[model samples]
Target: MKIRPKVTARALAVLGLGALVLSQAACASPTEPGAATTASAAGGFDYTDARGDTVTLDTVPHNIVMSEQAAAALIPYGIRPVGIWGSSTPDMSGVLAGLDVSGIESLGVSYGDVDVDKLASLEPDLVITGWYAGGYLGGLGAEDAEVSKQIEQVAPLITVSAQKSASASLDDWRGLAQTLGADVDSGTIADEKSTYDDAVSQLKSALAARPGTTAYAVAPSTQFYVAIPGEFAELIDYAEWGLDVRESPIARDSTSGSFSPVSWENAGDYTSDLLLYDTRAWTTPLAQVERDHPTVATLNAVARGHVVDWTTDATFNYASYTKQIALLTDAVKALPASE
Candidate 1:
């Protein structure tokens, strides 16, 4: 039987104390191969994950399993996970969309649907998930409490927090990659970072030239819904980088990254200079919105040809973020200035 670590009252205290204690825990475990060496390159490794849990192993993990988003960020960093879970299909617009995942086994599409028998066969030494709420999110264990227990039977786990802005979450991914022996100074990484910086600059310039331009993000299926900028990670990053992402009123208890459902007749209520149609869902595209919904067609943004595709499926990494920034910049530049 695989033995789990005993969590003391001190470890529980760490979580209650928040980020300061978490940072200290990280400090306690040096990532370098040769320090005072409780865990070394040849021996083992220890890391304080986003949840303030210290996950230690007898040896550094080679076979790993990951959530889809974690796979997106870590794959480019040269850490190919053995298995991935929680994506319905290869998201064509996602950051990892074009990546060749032929070698990686699929655990299943959604969070609670992993093939535990298949998962066991992989013999994963580590399982990486995204942190949300009081537990890990976006993997075999997240949506099901029983699944979390089952996952614990297979391997040790750690979570990279996705609770913050996209940029901050990317930083956490980078830090995790570094701990996993990625060369942060590699030429590939450097080039991607440079591209990201350039894209940000381009976006800033475009937004500056088109002052007072505002955008409303929406998904139009059978029902129309308006996105609240603060609720979505990518939208938060865009707003921070000078894009005016208009917020729709959200219920206090509503899910994060979810939009407020609205009637087609009320679509005109959230009018803005730009209409960002969510292309990630199986909804009506902006091109077809006018023919299907007369109310949406009457909006100023749509009439002026200011509608553009939006993807919340972007990977929170330099390469993916840079591409999105450039796409947004190009879309904004094509728009005519409002009178």
Candidate 2:
């Protein structure tokens, strides 16, 4: 499951404090072998996941079960899982776009809906998913402790954190994919990395040219949800790349402390030269949003047509990020400098 960066009240309430404490205390050192270890080692598969847990196996896992988001990251490197589960159908998942998943078994499509029996039937050697803040597992609800326990019983469960910056998360995936026996340094992977680097350079140049073009990333629902740039991997990358992405004061006062949800009537309170509008499936479409929340139309960014579609669920991979960065660069080029 691809988890959103935005933390809702319900999500906050379910966070496992004990898990969070364990994760902090057991945080592995940066130079740990498991972080950069390869599966080719004579001792067999040994890798440390985001939670800092070192999962050691007698042999490299050939049959794996992964969250669709994880599959998206690994598939590009030629690491295919035996089974996958997601928060949406494969066709509907933005992260799973342009990938071939015909041969993989579908464990489930909705959050917390994993078919444990089917997953076990596949005889998966490893179950890989994303680890999120609050100790939440991707595709599994925070409250679904029983399901998590059951999945753990079937196979060793591991994760890469979704809480890291896009680049950091991608690096983690690269290491994990290498541990899973992917040739990450050659052929298609190398070419993709070069392309991604070029895209990053282009985006930086674009932002440099468009000095002072402030942006506000947001999702429209019954409320106008302002994204906290620090909480989102892609948004953090954009900010670091020199875009003046605005921060929401509401996040400071929010119970979830991840995003600020303003009433539609107060949507005009936050404004920027450019608007990074969330276009995830869960958000209300921009056109419908404008019609329903007329106040949103009053924002200067909206009036000037300076809105850019932001894919919140983009995969943590060079290929996916190369496209995202290109789109943002184009948007930056089109945006006018702030007054």
Candidate 3:
């Protein structure tokens, strides 16, 4: 979910993934640093998560409760969760777009607002979510010790790292889904993987064709927030794929370090050939942003109409990223070569 520069403490808990360290009260169990793994022996379920804590159960967990991001990653692999909690409404969730969530129960519609009673009613066998660098669990407010403890009492919790490279994160999710008995080898999945690979290649080719065509990704709000490429999986992927995704001139003082809030007057400080605007964060039309923040029009990209909608909260699955990569590739191809 997009993080607002000004939001409630509860909302901040979810958005502060990069910088918010897990509180002792928020952790139900101790964590050790290790590579994530999934193993089953004698029909017992054992999965070591990003935090290196292994959760064991007598049987594979079928009744699962997941954070929105986790549900998006697993649902494509045919592993649907029984319930989900998210930072935004399901209909508005960019990560959950194109995925069917018709019957699943929504534990919460806002960040860190899970219905503990409803979550417990599901009698979930496990609770899975995305883990951030600072031990933060997606959708669970780390600052809400009582809620975290209550949720912990309901089921075993495991996490897949959200901070990893997009491709690596997708692999981790696939491994988790396989462990949960998903048909990862199904034709549908194979086809999507092929499509994703093609999309990646297309993106690389587009970048190669437009060498030095710089771009900056940003979310427009009351105060503009420039994306930090290193903190985001997709941005990191783009840079690695050869796109000149520019870093913000502003420092990373925000709670998450994922974005740095700057005044509109300073938005032009980091000029680029293309402006990848965060469509998920700002729902209004692009013209509205220009009208609201006159300074936005001063940027060369804005003046040249070289802006593209960037989905910052895209799902980590190949299917989701295939579309995102394709969109970015199209944007790259549309840009004029450096003067």
What local distance difference test score does each model get? 0.70, 0.77, 0.74
Candidate numbers sorted by lDDT from highest down: 2, 3, 1
By lDDT, is 1 or 3 better? 3
CA-only RMSD, every prediction: 7.6, 8.0, 8.4
Which tens-of-lDDT digit does each residue in 120-173 have in candidate 1?
Answer: 667777888877644546655453477776665566667777666787777778
lDDT by residue for model 3 (1-339), tens:
111121112222333342322222112233333232343345556666776666766567788989999999988888888888996766667779999887898889877788877876677777888887666778775624567766665566778887868887888888888878788876788899888989999988889888887888887776677888887888888888887888766776745257877777887686888888888754445788789877888898889878887886784788888888888888888886544
Clashes of 3: 0
* Candidate 3: clashing pairs of residues: none
CA displacement after TM-score superposition, residue 41 of candidate 3 (Å): 3.2
**Candidate 1, 237: how far from true, in Å?**
0.9
Residue 294: error of model 1 in Å? Answer: 0.8
Pairs clashing in candidate 2?
A: none
Model 2: how far residue 125 lies from native, Å: 0.6
C-alpha lDDT of residue 267 in model 3: 70
Work out the TM-score per prediction: 0.82, 0.86, 0.85
Worst 10 residues of 2 by lDDT: 1-10
For candidate 1, the 10 contiguous residues with the lowest summed lDDT are 18-27
